[model samples]
Target: MKTYNKLLLLFIFLLFCEGLQAQSKPSWIWYPGDFEVWLGNKMQSRRTERGTFLPPFWKFDSHYVLIDFHKDFDLQEAEEAELYVEGQYNVKIDGKAIFGYPNRLSIPAGKHKVSLKVFSQDKVPAIFVKGKKVVSDSTWLVTYEDKEWIDQSGKASDQSGTTWLKAAQWNFDNAATPPSAYALPTVPQSPVKTEKLGKSLLVDFGRETFGFIRLHGLKGRGEVAIYYGESPEEALSIDHGETLDRLDVQFDQKKDTLTTLTKAFRYVNVQLAPGMTVDSVSMLYEYAPVKDRGSFHCSDEEINKIYDVAKYTFHLNTREFFIDGIKRDRWIWSGDAYQSFLMNYYLLYDSPTVTRTLLALRGKDPVTSHTNTIMDYTFYWFMGIQDYYLYTGDRSFVEQFYPRMKTLMDYCLSRTNKNGMLEGLAGDWVFIDWAEGLSKQGELSFEQLLFARSLETMATSAALINHQEDAVTYGEMAKKLKSAIMAKYWNKEKQALVHSSIDGKQTDNVTRYSNMFGIFFGYFNADQQQGVKKNVLLNDKVQKITTPYMRFYELEALCALGEQSYVLKEMKAYWGGMLKEGATSFWEEYDPSKKGAEHLSMYGRPFGKSLCHAWGASPLYLLGKYYLGIKPLSPAYETWEVVPELGGLKWMEGKVPTPAGEIELYCSTKEIRVKSPVGKGTLRFKSKSLPKVKGGGGLLNKGNGNYEITIIKGKDCVVKYN
Candidate 1:
């Protein structure tokens, strides 16, 4: 009898231990999107021009100052927990307040609620809870306001009006690491050489880098002024420099002082008063710790150099979010970020950055103005979502924000003209490209194409969230708009879609904007596709695209039409031109005709253009999707296709990141080798002779020298061809 009782007790204890082990891993959590908004405001406000604070012209928003977080757990046994918070906070259990900020507390078993209410003015309100069974994670709920109030009789009133969302988290898994202390990692770097003239010192960092400048052995009682520039001319012109800083320091001993803000520059012109003295100057090069998963190398050294510069340019622009540039306008623009999203999916495959940028761009919105106040940019936001879903297959993201998508679409729908088409209303910036003589008048065919695509995104999102009615409505709307685009803009004589319509008649203009998008969007039939290719795309008479922003789509259109060879040459000419001018990073705009100082000038201001822009890194996408020809046929890359097109290269090798794992490939003229960590892939290529498969089975021979072989997950496949 005694042995039996002891055995039963041991069994019960073992079961309890198993339950404790099953607890989810703890992570830092906060109100959804509150940290991102707070961080964005912090990042954007750091911009300065000639010692003058330069904030965005548009309204800058902040996160909620106060938040209440709570979670209910039914523990099998009693537990003890510790709390860490970013702001002044209070804790409660089962509606009973704890006396003070208790570092640790004990809770009894049997379904109870643990809550924390935090308030802050400058930083985001966040918390990290560590315990055995009750830990902080996304499972917890957070709200800006908890309306549970006590009546006169001390009875709680209805708390139905308060809204709660699952807590948001990133890589802040360590309890000691809070969102408020987030900063990009940095490394120490010395200047290439220094040139001193009287009280002025010109320091060159050799190449374009961004970070806080450090002053060593600084014992000064006067003012120290620093002017930063991407060009030597801009740095020397103190008054017109885009970014500068002035510091008033009074140090008793030799101590190192770091600048409060990070700036983009290759050269710094530092001037000091008589009393101010500095031994040397260095920099803390700040950067995100992202692994370069995708790579490209070919026989052409110029292409390789272009690829390297593009990668560096992308890394500089890819910080907290896909920013427009490192030098100026650090604000997130939807159109710029859309290209960044594509490039990131190909290179780093950093889904967290993608979602963060999307959510930050799509703020808690009544959809006041188009994203970045541009009509086409708003549509890019929607298209970004579609791409995010296709690449990540994160349905929860779509489900959580489906309502916001509907509201944004509704805003667009409400602004449409009486003829059921999007037209520029008052205060609407119909920015298609940054070209002279471009008109923002009447209804643009480009805007309608974007609108139709946005509707399709809404339809796809609605279906994912089980909003069947909304799905049907958006589907019908997309179909209708697409039909209208074909009927209204299709210029048979011009063999292209007209740029815009005035009053009610279509214009005679034939721009590449809508026509190029039509090719990728599949709006054009076989005949129309060929016609647009000849009339608009191939026609050099059309206004040439100046910015990489539009060049991304233009190149993509050409690649879709199997014009990879032509697109590669164009990329070489456009992106290569910037490289020849000693560009360490790709520029916001590169005009081959512009010479020396002319190349640096833009927007009517000297050195107005950004040296490193996210959109300038489109070759990452073009090379990955077109040349490597690896894309997901299904969401999350469950089933994908690899159709390697050399695009006029002797051989090309690269990796494409997927949700599950990476797909690796190496291709030459006579042999091809490919391997994937996940997904059922189809490897297709064109060869004049029969291709033999090794380490795999079954090759499908499509007529006319096209062949395909099935690639299963976790297997290496090689093919030999003539």
Candidate 2:
């Protein structure tokens, strides 16, 4: 009897421990990438023009309305699991249907499969299942079309084919919160000042803002019209403002009225009817809850202010996906989002946002048109993925999306002319930049450069997915294209790559686009790089880059060539130029030559420019990658380097986040301090003398005024140099 009792006690203890192990952290999950598609459509459709709804001109896709989610679990004892779903759903256990959508169901002790089929047209099909060993998470498998067919006799078909993918999830961990109820967190914000004009009020929120407008203590019954503006002039122009809200009220008592959709504006002109009345105006500021992981502080206050405003501009534009601007477009353009991805790595480092944006941009591709209807934008999408992999080293994302990448590349290759060069095709927009008088007539060198880089991206992704044959094919294509670009576009006389080729003849037009890219791509020899830098990049004859989009790469190429000092002054002059004009956030475009209200005009409208744009925030990337000089040399940051360039700053310190953690550094002419949370890092610096070490001593004094040190994980290394 004693032996039997002891055995029973051991069994009970094992069962208790198993039960505890089964109930791990539970979170809401959905068909991977589906929520992004759904939310993107909803957000993009919110644009209105003078109270009339305006949708994207390009084709838009929708998420699969029906989905089946299931996971198998084994439990020591029977447990009851709660079910929460975003839409109408049915629950089943081990092929046995529950009587209804049970709030709680008994999942038996033995191995059992729990499944839920949900249908939602407007919202993503998502579910949260919490139980002792049966929690919903990424581990759950989901299928849009289960393809389960039954005969008249009610036996299921054996040949039923279904493709299931692991579910996608974010930070929606609470059971009470479902995907349909999702909205960015909002906070109350008041106007800086308001001016009354009879039944009209003009309110300035003090800066560029985005959110719902609220009329506080609105009582009388009539109609109230609100005009939104990024500038005060835009708000006052009721006839031409891009966005406006109108409400027909019949309030018997005082109540606050808020607009249904969010708008981007800093100033609002509220015009009330003869009867309508509002005591005050405020707003519910909607914003992404992303933690700022990277930072920059330098001696130049102007540069610091530019960084802060640029950071704010990026955060505001980085909502569901990296949008073009808050006011106009409000759509994810691949080129714009590509810059946002780079900036994000230096700022938020939110992997999910990057993945989500990539997936959404790809959509469900039958390859109809280029991303955002621009040829360069499509290549930008692929290049963005390359950077994404190098920065995060998440192979699973590439694995899931490699097929999509292949199809897009195939579309590009198909569009190439007989000579394997990309020229204009019907319905294809060859948007290199927004420069006036720019030609799109012939095979463009810029397109080929981007194409070669995109091919390399595919090659890298193919290798990651173990597609050796595809990898070789893409690698050969990339090499061929690179050689062709150099052979066809290189102008020996001009010492630069010309802009385009007409009928196999190089155009005399030498543009900065391809030449600057070639410098960073290593397509040019050392001699060729110097030649192009002097003739094309530094030459005033080459049309200067005006838009921040191209400026991002132009500056990057300069930084790559160790011209950070020159780039720093350009940054201050360009980005600081905007700051000098009382810009709360960076503008979509700025030309110092444009005087007064002309700064606010673009696209032929008086106030057609967006005051805050994503591409305008490139300094976040420049400061982190080039100035801080911390970059990954291997996948997942297992091997990295820290080569700090002061770039004429008195002293600088910042953090560069990695999958492991942050690589923090402080640098001055006299000393350097470094710490890494993970990965082994190499610290390379140029010192006037042999550097002395503090903390952990491993400084190696290489000859020729150069020093090197190794940084191990979770340790601090300080060096006194110069």
Candidate 3:
């Protein structure tokens, strides 16, 4: 009887071990390249393309120009004579031609080579001319030659040292003839009109020029087009057309040139015809680029180009067969938006960068020269550094910035009041501008809740690194603060968490932000979770729930509740909703009907708001680490824990590169597999349906160069291999 009992126990232990080995595969493979592009590709068929110059044009500092025409003539003739240029295969003047003049010449906007041929009845004389544009009564020309012309070597030359020439000298004896000079018809200037279109700012003007558009306190990317019309309404209607092929001017950074293209005009025409009165002409644009400093310089068209390249790389490498061919650096850029997107790509491909500029940024001044606060900038820096450390396991970086990180974390901790809560103005608050529940003053509860949650993340990160003492102190403080928050804000009778408390009594109002914080911070008990799930997820009063802009936080809260299936549903809906709504990237908010609405910002203009690459990227990383279950376990940085949570996903597979080594996991309907370097460690399998493992010795000894585990069952496994 005793022998039979022991054998039965051994069989039970073996079955448990097998169950623990059943790992779920990851839905997406994270690599060092841009993952957002991959996400975009999976949902869309076409990738965004890069900027390509049509020819005879030079790109410079986000602008393009033709350098040859102005270099050979003098001020008087160049200003008086009209130039007719075409981007064919070569250049011709007055039906006569010049050899070696590039037809489709592509050059950066700075100084470049211009080969000109002058043909006349007799030998033509060499001429030099000044380039100028006449605007109304004023002649707007390059006066300071030093600043106007950047030489081939990118050096500035003084205009005083240069000379101009006449059109007669260039071969035109009848310089005043009809074809010798070109004139642009003047369009009357009308009053400027401003309108709010969906979540965008539409600025209409009466005329167009090569002038600068200054955004006083704005940071975003959008299409800026010059449109013509007789009245404001007609102009707005024409500008808002879905299929209008309006002129687009793009600044090419690589060649330092500006390239402008129009549908069928020698130059972009903005004139009001005989039958038409000057109604309104303005630049209609959209702000959807990833939000970050320095990233604001690029226009929407330019950003779309970069986004396209990124998406292409992501789609090409999503399959397991192509994993080894991934190029990690193809998407790396110094720009904030590019860098943030690169970090997400790095998770899929285990690659590291030698540069630590992002790390230094976190420790330096957080204040932006613009209206954005220190916290707004610092949050991105911290997130970047944390992601770097999490993937690379580079202690050198952690050691270098640990003190500064602690300083920032300590400062956040210090902000807690006697009630263990802190309140501050929410930076980048435009994402929730449509919420009618917000008071004019501010949402105190939402502000405090975000701070508290940020602190908790910091504390938890510290604890993950084996800073037991520091973690304990921070964790304890977090718990205490959470307790105080519940006691002060939660209403047992109402079955809802109040928005805020003034002196003691709770306010009865419930907000999406407040409730999201409660679930996100784990302030709710099991019963409270049920109430929130019912009220927020299933209740008709909360029918709209929150806008797509807040989908990141919403999904995060759902994940916190271990509701993977529910979160997956929301992810699909949010992603599909944005794509169908004509989003080039994830938007700040969602509109189901495609209304020409603008996202509201506290600073007034929607362009002043951060759009694409803001805090939205946090969800991609979180989904990769938590829901996908490819998380690191040691601060020493050598090994990672392969715990798979299938989360309703079909067959999934991906690789996570860590400082220690690379670990690959794959799962299918029939079987699950985990591969890593040989090391001895215990594996824990977690599931409510699975029974606990009894005394059967947990560690697996390493023998071969590699370790492999296979199981055939459900998708829940925790392997603590060294």
TM-score of each: 0.95, 0.95, 0.45
Q: Residues 1-722, candidate 3: write the lDDT tens digits.
A: 99999999999997676454322111111111112222222212211111222221111111011222222211111222223222222333322345564323222233333323323221111223212321111111111112235568665443455422211111122323222232212222232555545432355542221111222222222343433221233234443311122223232221111222211010122322222222233222211122111110112232223333323223222221112111111121222322333334334332222222342233222322211233323343444544555555555545434555677666555545566665443443222224655542322566555455555556656765667787777667667766666777777775667666766667666656667657855667889987877776445566254444355556667676677767655655555554444333343345454443443121353222222323233344444544445554443334345445556665456544444444456543333445544232223334323222222233333344233333212233333322
For every candidate, C-alpha RMSD to the true structure in Å: 3.0, 3.0, 23.0
| Local accuracy by lDDT, each model | 0.88, 0.88, 0.38
* Span of ten consecutive residues with least summed lDDT in model 1: 153-162
Q: Write the per-residue lDDT of candidate 2 for residues 86-144, one digit (tens) a residue.
A: 88898878766789778887988889888889998878888998886778888899989
Of the candidates numbered 1 and 2, which has the greater lDDT value?
A: 2
- Candidate 2 vs candidate 3, TM-score winner: 2
Go through the candidates in order and give the clash count of each: 0, 0, 59
Lowest-sum lDDT 10-residue window in model 3: 56-65
Give the alpha carbon lDDT tens digit for every residue of 26-69 in model 1.
Answer: 88898887777788778878777666788876556678889998
